[model samples]
Structures are given as C-alpha cells and as structure tokens.
Target: MDLASEEDKEITIGAFNGWDESYAAAYNTKYALEQDGFTVAVESFDAGPAFTAVSQGDIDFIMDGWLPVTHEDYIQQFGDDMEAQGCWYIDAKNTIAVNEDSPAQSMADLADMADEYGSTIYGIEAGAGLTRMMQDNMIPTYGLEDWDFKISSTPAMLAQLASSTDAGENIVVTLWRPHWAYDAFPVRDLEDPEGAMGAGEVVYNFSYAGFTEDHPQVSQLLKNLVISDEDLASMENIMFSDDHYGGEDPDGAVAEWVEENDSFVSDWKAGALAG
Candidate 1:
C-alpha cells in the first residue's frame, strides 16, 4: 500500500471520557496519523456510548479498551461489528489504591481500618466496570457493605486523592495501571487476596467493522503498535501534567513525546507502511 495513495485519509478516533490513557493513546495515534499525511479527529465519550458509536461506524477506532473483564459487557454487545486490533499494552489492572503509608495493605484490611480511612471508598463513574467490580465483588467479599462507596467522576476522585495525600491523611480510591497517577501520586494498589478485582488485563485497540479493509495502512499501524509501560508512563506524565492538561497546545505535548521517541516512531511507521 502506498501511504500517499490511500483514499480514506480522514479518520475519527474515539476515547473514553476522563481516561488519561485513552486520550494519551488517541492523541499519540493522531500525531502519528497526521505525520503520515492523514487528518485525524479525536472525540471523547463514556465507555458505553463509545462502543455504540464505533459499532455504528460513528468513529473509526479506540485505543483504550481493557479486555477479558473490564469491558466485557460492551464487547458482548458490539463485538460482531468491531475488530480487535490486538493488545498494545499488557499488565492492565483495575485497582483500589491507598496512600503509600496507609497501614491497610489489602482489601481485607479496609474493613477494619474503615474509620481510619474515613469509612469511604472513592470511585470513578458509577457505570465504569471498575466501579461495578467494586460494588459487586470487592466490597461484599471484603465485608465493606456498610462503608461509603462514593461514586463520582475520575477527576473528582483524583482531586480528593490529591487533597488527602497532600495532608498526609489516609485515603482510598479506585484506580488502574497504565495510569499516570501511580507515577505522580504517593499511592499504591491494595492487594486483593480473593481476586475480586480479577487478573491483569490487556489493553486493546478496537475498530469499527471493515475499518481494516477501508484503510489497510492504518490497520497495519494498529496491528504494529505496542507501547512499553515506561514509554507510556513518560508520555502520560507529560500529557496530564499541570502545564499540558487543558492547555492550548495539546498536540505539542504529543509532539514532544514523539521527538523523544523518534527512533521508535520511525520503526513503527516503517513497519506499518511495509505491510
């Protein structure tokens, strides 16, 4: 396939709302696509609607899907109209994290230390799969039925996390790996001895039906994409940092990341075009 001869060069990428990894991947992929002389637009939606839009061909692809567990319901509903482009990131896991110095080290310990941690478990959107797992599995299994499971937006939860941690107060909040928080905050995941949180999952790129056939080069790019934890973290750290978050130059951040990983970018582009 000649990159310059592609007919469908304009693309729409979907991302989940308030998901750092989602936007990080979307913008990064946007940068790559733009570099290849393709026009890209990224739109954000909650998980459910994002899946629906992609299945209906409203968007071309999304890069922040967690497989085998987190996003299982959406997949079951829309899998027939979507293509799994393969995992770009492995070791993805939903977690309930607490301050690093907190005495409670596991979900089992949260029940007893409820008062110390304010008898609350902060969480992201109520509809999120992470929230569902906590409500249905982790909370009950760990005897935290009476505890406050506060449902709110991811930013709100993170704000609370920031305030609590800054005060040296104990706090617990729902979080996930492949996230910038682990690097920016003084927090750690609580052990789930009973496996209520499920095993680690892989992050996949999904496209609408026939997306591959429509844009073979982009499909090849998706297939060839694989980001290491270290690189992803670095990019996200820059992306979500105070200077870049909601800043005027969002693309500049991605450009900076790309400049830093020029060799990887070159190899990735070459591999995709070679197909």
Candidate 2:
C-alpha cells in the first residue's frame, strides 16, 4: 500500500489591522475550527496588503471583505483564487461624520462652510477603499475640488476627531457604522447629496480555493455563519460598557453566544459531517 504524503496541513487566516470590527468574527471562526482538531494560524495585514497577499496565496484567507462595493477590484482579481466562505455582517455602512455642533449638516452644507471647516476633510489612510471613494467620487461629485482632504490612519484620525469634538469645533472625518466609534461617540452622519459613497454593504469571508475540500467540516461551519447588526452591536457594547469591559474580545463573546445558541449551532453542524 502507498503511504500518504508526509507534509502536514494547516490553515492560515488573514485579517486587516487588529482593531478591525471583523477581528472578533475571525477569532470566533478560528476557535471553532481549532475545536475540530485543525491546526490554524492567524495572520494580520493592512487591508490593502491583506488583499494582495490573499491573491498571491501568501495568506489562506481574509474574513473581512466588504462587498458589492469597497474592494471591488480586489474581489474580482482574487475571488477566483479563493472560496467565499460566508456573510459576516450584512449592513456595514460608511459615513462622513462631523462634530455634533458643526454647521455642516450634509455634503451640501460642507460646501457652504468649507472656509470655516478649513476646506479640508479628514479621512482614514489614503489607501483605504473608502478614502479613495471620498477623493475620486465624493469630492469631485460634490464639487469640492478646491477642498483639501487629510489622509491619516484610523487612530490618528480618531484622535483628531476627539480633540475637535471635545472643543465643539467644526470638523469632518470619514466614519462608518458598526464600528467602535459609533458606540463611543455622538457624531452625526452627513447627508449625501450625490450618493457617491453608495449605501451600506454586505461583509463576507473568503478562504483559499481548496479550504472547503481540505476542511469540509470547518467550511460548513463558516458557510452557516451569519451575523446581524444586533450581534455586532452586542460585541461593541461589551467593549464600551465600562472602563473594565476590556476590548475586542470577539472570540470569547462568540463562544459564549454559540453555547447559548446550541440549537442554532447544531443546525450549522448538521450535514457538515457528510462532506
């Protein structure tokens, strides 16, 4: 009889920065897979770098692709190279939030207050898909050609926002729903006159092409995965409930949720063994 190949098998999952909202779901999935006896590795990369790495197969998967919009090109190029696991969050929306007292109530309002607001828009890292959308579409479409946009990473941008909001100064920063900021701050989303940013999007997971074949049971669990706004909100709430609530404990919360939803978990596990 021929011996099977000696090479060991392991799954590597990729994620954006450690602070991304999807980090929790990714950890939860990792925990679930490990429970089934598979050796798994978790890797972190910048959002843009993560897409490139996954495309080149340097990473096994990224569980945080916001869909039908952001990262559209990345999905098109690398999607065929991987298997889409499942939907994570269905309505992840991006917003342009200004300080609560800012006179700019909408994109149109920004035009009138461009001078007072410094003729500049605060954005996350320039490479972020949303930042590109803001520059390539929101700016031009809204006719803010002369307006300047400052691109900084999330922590940096949020820091600027905190300073401005605390002083009740005029400020605008790219924001998103289902993010920790929504739970921690009272900023408002500016109305879109041209609708350039598009509506909320569906977030999903992706794995290497043969992941399902190599780990059918684990793939099944991923396929049955579905998270709603309430689910995400609960996680965010825990992170902000108190100074002692800790932060971003997605895996722990997921495990707790699963145990409390045994019937639902069983349904997901059902038929998975046949694969």
Candidate 3:
C-alpha cells in the first residue's frame, strides 16, 4: 500500500492585506490548523488576485469573502469552481467615514461639499471589492464624479485619517466595520441613501472544490467557526496595536490572542470535532 503523501498534511490559505479582519482571521485559522498537525501556508494578495488565486487552484481557500454586495460578482464569476465553507461574521459593513464633527453626515452631503475633504475621497486598495463597488456603482449613482477617488492602500488612508482627525480637521475615507480604525479614531460612517455602495454583508470562508473531502478536519473547523463583532474588533485591534505586535509578526500576535482567549479557542476546536 502507498503511504499518505506529505501534501495531505499541508493546506495553503490565501488572504488580503488591506483589510485587518482578513489577516486576523487568516492568522487565527492558521494557528488552529497548526494545532491539528497540519502545515498552513498563508499567501497575501489584493482582493481581486486572492479570488483569482483560489478559483484557479493557486491556493486552497481564503477567509475574507464579504457577500451579497461586496463580492457578489466574484461568487457569480467563479460559480461551482469554488464553494463557501461557512459564514463566520455577519453584517460586514462598508462605510464612508468622516470626522464626527464634520458637516457631511451622508454620501449626498459629500457630493456637495467636496472641498472640505480636499475634493478627494481617501480609498483603500484599488482592487478591493469595496473600491470596485464605489467606482462602478456608488460614484455614478450618486453623481460623485467631481471627487477624486484616491486609490491607495489601507495604511496610507489610515495615516491620512490620523493626520487630519488629530488636527480637528475634516476627512472622509472608505472604511469598514469590525476594523480597529473605529476604535483608534473619532469617526462615523456616512449614510448612503441610495444604497450604491451595497448594504450589510456577511464574511465567509470560501474554498476550492473538494477541499473539504481532502482536509475534512481543517475544513470542518473553518465551517464551524463563528465570531462576533466585539470579539472580532478586539482581536483585530490587538493585531493593529503597536504595543502588541508593532505591526509585524501577525502570527505572534495571533498566538497571544489565542492564549488570552483559551476557552473560546478550545470551544471552537472541540465543537468542530464533535459536530
């Protein structure tokens, strides 16, 4: 009889970097997989590339698919080639946040007073699903053609938010819920009356076909995974904190978080095995 291949004990996980919760979840899941005597390889890419990687069988799966709005097209595109293991987080919000004191309280307001924000809307990675929706749907739907959409990385946008908010100046940027930025800065999400940027979505664990049958235990654990907004934000904040990991070594940070929440981690793994 042939011995089991070493590849059977290994799993590759793809993740996107611009979003903190994506990294946090990917790292957390990686740790859990390691505990089960499996080697997990995590590769980071922009949202578009990440989806392409999974669909093309370049990576086993990714844990950051926001659905019903943000990544709906991706799901339609990939079709039966990929499948969702489970939904772990709900109402995954996309936002246009501004300083709490800013005059603009809604997307409509932003269209009128673009000068207050320097005629530019700070944005995250251009390949992000959120960025795409904003460009293709929101901008045209809301008549926001005048505002310059500054497509950049998340950190750069956060830096601009920090600089402007610190000086009591107004700034608006594309942001998301369950992110550390909500805790680190005094900002509020703008109202989108037109629902152009999509509505509340759920974050999902998506994998290539037959991933579950090949790696049942690991797949089950991910499918049984459930996380709340408070706990998620706390974990993400730890990963983002300078005093925690200093923005480096996400695995170390995840290990620390796992240790602190031993009961939660224990329950997660045990529940998976039991079910």
Candidate 4:
C-alpha cells in the first residue's frame, strides 16, 4: 500500500470512443493515481472492444460502464472476468432529444413531425447499446419505421446537432444524460411514453478480475470515488470545450479542474488511503 512502491505502479484505463464522460472519468482517475505516484495510461475503443479488452485482462479497467440496462449484455458476457469497482454516477439514461424550440414534446410526436426533422434521427456508433435500443425498440414502438435512422460517430451526431441548431432548424438525435451536449446545446429530451429507452442506469467502474488483488490500494481508491452530476457536468464542460476537443490537452483540463477543486481531490484521496 506504499504510495512510493515500485510494484503495481503502472495502470491502464480503457474508454469508449467519442464518449465525453468516459474521457472525464479516465483522465480524472489518471490524475488521481498520478498524485499517488502511479503511472496511468488512458486508451479509447468502441464499447464492445473496450469491454473485451478489460475482460481479457488486456487493460486494467474502465470508468464508464452503464449497467443493468445500457450494457447489460456486455456485463453478462464479461462480468465473470471482471470486478465491479462501484457506481460513480447514477440516474443516467439514454434519450432522443431535440432543440428546446421544437414542437415535438414526446417520442410519439416524432413520427408525425418526421418531415420537419428531415425524416432523420441522428445516432452514435452502430455498436452502441443506445443504437441497439433505438433500432430494436424505440423506432418500431414509436412507428418510425419509415424514418431514416442515421448511424455515425458521436462527434458526427454532435456536429449535425450544432449545425441544425445554428440554422434554427428542427433536428432529432439520440443522446444521453451526464453528457456535455446537454450543456453545450439548446436541447431537451423527448418524453418516452412507451419507456422503450429503459429506466435510469448507474455508471460503474470495472477492473480485470485480479486488479483488486494486485493493487488493493488503487482498488480502494476507485471504490471510494463518486462524482455528482453537477460536478461531472462542469468538468466535462471544460474537457469537451473547443480548446480541448479531439484529444487536445485533456490532461491539462483535468489538472485545471483538480486545481480548482483541491479540497474535493484531497478528501477523496485521503478517504481511500486512510486506515
């Protein structure tokens, strides 16, 4: 448990591509571990590959696994090979959102106003659980079979959102809570009367099976971690800003956040390392 120990000094964290919360969690943990004299590496991959890497012990852990819903299949497949560190954020949900001024107030309304939205519903990566839900449930449940469900990266969807909003045009996109987009864009989630998107979920950290045994102190640190929505949103607002987007200086953003919230950082570290 010695902070200066040479053993278990290095760690690797896996993240989903273009997920802002994933980056926020990974980089925040990296900074914290570094403060304890541990070296950490943050790597990005699609959800499926990221889960595979962590389960097979190719990486140490991941800080962003939405559970009991969004990633139920991944956990059912890989849970035996990994340990749930804990839930760090809660009440998370996948959503289909539109600008505040849009006339559609619910999912049911989308079908009738499909033409106004250009008959398209922008979405993130095809492999994302949100994408699966939309394809298998939301679309069919809401009678949107004839509408176009555009599949692309998260950044692409965000770009489309930005463009549409700027032009004062109605647009619909699949999104989620605890996301920076909610703050960055003038959007609101459409009410899902059918509840096809599922209920609120918890975001958890999962490490390789033997990670806790190999690094008990670090494991304890992770177990003690919890981030509030406001704090997480604030950090992400900075991390995903124009200056820090596209893998530019995210570490610096974390550093700035840490500096601004020294007491919170100190309390978290002390609670974990305390006997």
Candidate 5:
C-alpha cells in the first residue's frame, strides 16, 4: 500500500476574504472537493500572501487569480512554480463606479466632475491590486490630479456606497465584478477608454506545477467550472445574505448554491470523472 510516494488525500484551498468572487469560488469548490471525499482544508490570506503561499506549495491552489492585469506581477514573480488554469469567470474586472444617476459616464468625465462626487474616490483595501492600479494608472491617465483616492477596506467602501446611494448622492468607488453589490445597489462602471486598468479581468484557478498529474480528478473539476456573472452573483446573494450568515452563522451557503445548481455541478463532476 505504501509502494509510491504518499498521495495527499487532503487538499488545501487558499483564498482571501472580503473579495467576494475569490471567496465564493474557493468556498464553493471546497464543498465540491468534500463531496468527492477529499478532506478540504481552507486557508485565508491577503492577495499577496496567497500568491506566495501557492507558489511555495504551502497552499495547494487558489481559485481567484484575476489575470492579464491584476495579479500579473505576482504571477511573474512566483508563477514559475504555478500552473495557471482555466478562466472560470471571464468578466472579472475592476472599475470606478458612481450612482446610476451620476452625470459622469466614463473615466474621462470623472476629472471634471470630481467636485460633483465630493472630490473623493472611495476605494477598497490599500493593499489591493485594484487600488494599486487605480492609484498608479487610472488617476494619472484620467487627469484626476485634484481628486482624492481614499483607501479603505471593501466592506467600508461598500458601506460608503450604501449611505451615499440611500440619500441619492453622487459617489464613486473602486468596485469589481462577481460582487453581490450589483444586486444590492444601483451603480455602473465608468468606461475606461484609455484602458488604464487594462481589459476586463478573467478569474483563474491557479495550482502548483504537476497538480493535474498529482490530483487528476479534482483538477479537471476546477478547470471545467466555467460560470457566468449572473450565476456567481446569485450564489453570492444567497450565501452572503444577512438572512443567512449575518443573521446567524455561515449556514452552509455554498452547499445550498450547489444544490440549487445541481445540473451545473453534476456536469462539472461528470467531466472530471471522464477526464
């Protein structure tokens, strides 16, 4: 029975909290692995640490790499040891959004209308890649020299959006796709013609080299899990609903999402088996 190198029956999935898309994918996949009899260990970290952990094989894999821009530097640094997998969610991206009623329709318009938005651009965590990109690229490229890019956590930023939106005030913040806020509020992304933030992002499942060869079944399932914004948002809505989590405990939201999307989950599992 011990003829070969001991195979790890347990797989650890690394993720970062506050980022809804990342959290959703990793949490849901953890449940899926459990269904396949794999003891799933979950770990949480900031984006940078998560990248390094996966690179050193300290963490098995991550399901929320926003590629082609966000996480590019991290991949360049540690990606030699990483196997970037499928683009599970293609519309993943970051943007500056204002109330749907705001007059500024694009990044170009933000500079002139900064006063209208209270001369402030509320942003997520200071360490976020999106924040870096906005600070380093978007503001300068858009001629928003007079505006303030306020650094705050995602939850805080969302709260700001809530208060601003409730009073029908014009407010802009750094937001991304695959978030529950789209359903919870009326906001739209400001068009970026200069491509300061690069093209729309695609969230990828990243594993260490030889992951497929070592764990073929689970690898295939993660690779085959292609979901749209609506599907993911629906999952977030249920899993993160106050009635579910904040009202009590986590309440097995991912499993509930899987059960609701039994057809999709079944197809992915079948593909893995066949692969």
Candidate 6:
C-alpha cells in the first residue's frame, strides 16, 4: 500500500525532475515522516510528465513547486485539479549562470560576448516556465532575437553547463537559487537589464484534489511545514558535500542530518503534531 493508504501506511511521493535536489530531500523527509509514524515511497519524473502524473492522481505530492510565477502556467493548467498543500521556501530567485572564465558579468556583457558565447543561450526543458519566460519575455525585452536559445531537458542542459564550465568556456544558461547547482558551480547570475525574469520566488508543496481527506496526517504535516533560507542553505550544503555525509547517498546524509538536528526538524514537523 502507498503511504497514504497504510495505517501508518507508506505514501508514494514523487519529484518533478530526477536530477533535482528535491529527490534527495524527499528521502530525508520520508525518513523523518517514518520516524514520526508514516511510510514514504519517493520517485521522480521530468517536469511535463510529473505534472501529468500528479494531475491524474498517480503521485501524491511534489515539494519543488516553484511558484506563484515560475510554474504559474502549470499550476493554472492543473490548479483546479490539484491542491496546493503549502509553501516550503520563500523569496527565491531564478538566475542566469555563465561560465567563470567568461568576461560576461551581466546580461549586457553577454551582448558583447555573443561571439565568444557562440551566440546562444542554453535553457532547460523547452516548455518549462523559465524557458518560456526567457523566450516570450526576456529575449524580446533585451533584444536578443539574434541569439539562439537552446532548449534541452534538465540533465542535458546541466550536463552541457558542467562541461562548458569545466572547460572555462563562455556559456550562459538558466539557473536558480536554493539549489545545489548554485553551491556546486563557480558561476554568477548575469545582471538583467530589463528585469523580465522577475526577482522573487517561493517553493510550494502541491497535491491532487481530495488528497487532504485521503491522507489527513500527511497533509497536516505538509501544511505546517516551512523552512528558512538559512536552514535550506545548510541542508543543501551538507547534501552537496563529500558525495556522502552519512554515506554515498545524499538522501541518507540528509536523513541523518535531520535526525541529528532534532530542534530544527521539530520546528518544521513537530508543529503539525501539535495543532
């Protein structure tokens, strides 16, 4: 039985993308939820497929719902059919990461470095909110019609980023904060001249309709959950380092960290148990 069905049942939780940090974090949360008397089965899918699954009630929830803007279109399409469980992180921002070797320190710099950058701006998942925002807004706002913006899946885009960054070549790609990539890479967000990408973001936990009634306890846990930037940064730091703080698995390390930091964990989970 899925966590949602068990008397102390295991719930099937899933992520939007396989490579996202949320996959590891979900396992950490799963461990804590189990310790609190629940079971969890975690899984992952690319953005489009994940939305379809969640909308069709195939998955319980996704913790990486970047919102009220970035994933706005997805939510609009799926909102009536899904329940937004809670907000997890606030004041998030999307970034434009460029190779450290590039002389481009800002969006304007990219204009001059276009030749060096191969006249391209790489982005993740063509239909993704960020990519669409860049295509429909940022490019036009900044007059980047001449530049080719490449759209590939998250892993492919990041893999290319890693390769380009490693080679100290000039490359620009969509990036975001409160994500491991920000910590792992020596990159900077290109300065935006038009501000079309916006400046703030928040992470939300979302589920399909009727989920609250089906899994009241888990819903309560999710509704009561909130984490600060500092807490998230610390968690991200630990999971990204050594390939293993609790072993080779980032999820295991996060689980151990949460267990050890009872006080902090309590702030996010224990509250649900209280009221």
Each model's lDDT comes to 0.85, 0.71, 0.82, 0.86, 0.79, 0.72
Tens-digit per-residue lDDT, 37-144, candidate 1: 899999989999999999999999999888888799999999999998767888798888999999999889988897898899999998988899999999999999
Per-residue lDDT of candidate 3, residues 1-275 (tens digit):
01122248777888886678888889898887777667888899988888888988889999999888778888888857887888888858877899999999789887788778888889999898789988998788878898889999987998999899999998989988878777677888899998977778889999988887776767777877888766687788788865467568988888888888887677786664223
Candidate 1 TM-score over all chains jointly = 0.79
Off by over 4 Å in 1: 1-7, 46-49, 56-58, 111-120, 125-129, 145-152, 241-243, 247-249, 260-262, 270-275
Pairs of residues at least 3 apart in sequence or in different chains that clash in candidate 3: none
TM-score for each candidate, following the candidate numbering: 0.79, 0.67, 0.73, 0.78, 0.78, 0.66
The global Cα lDDT (0 to 1) of model 6 is 0.72
Error of 6 at 207 (Å): 3.5
Question: lDDT, candidate 5, residue 204?
Answer: 88
Across 1-275, the per-residue lDDT of candidate 4 in tens digits comes to: 34455477889999898778899989998998898788899998999999999999999999999878778999999999999997888869989999999999999998889778988999999999899999999999999999999999888998999999989999999998888777677899999999999898899999999888888878877887888766787688779866345457889989988888777667776664222
Write down the lDDT that model 1 would get: 0.85
Q: What is the lDDT of residue 259 in candidate 5?
A: 77
User: What tens digits encode model 2's per-residue C-alpha lDDT throughout 151-226?
Assistant: 8897778788777877878888898767656545557788887788788888878877787676565666677777
- Candidate 2 lDDT trough over 10 residues, lowest sum: 1-10
Q: After superposition, how far is residue 203 of candidate 2 from its true place, in Å?
A: 2.1
- Candidate 1: residue 248 lDDT (0-100): 36
- Candidate 3 least-lDDT 10 residues: 1-10
Specify the highest-TM-score model's number: 1
The residue-by-residue lDDT of candidate 6 on 56-125, one tens digit each, is 8998887778777767888988888789888767757866878766788777677667788898988888
| Candidate 1 lDDT score at position 67 | 85
Whole-model lDDT for model 3 versus the true structure?
0.82
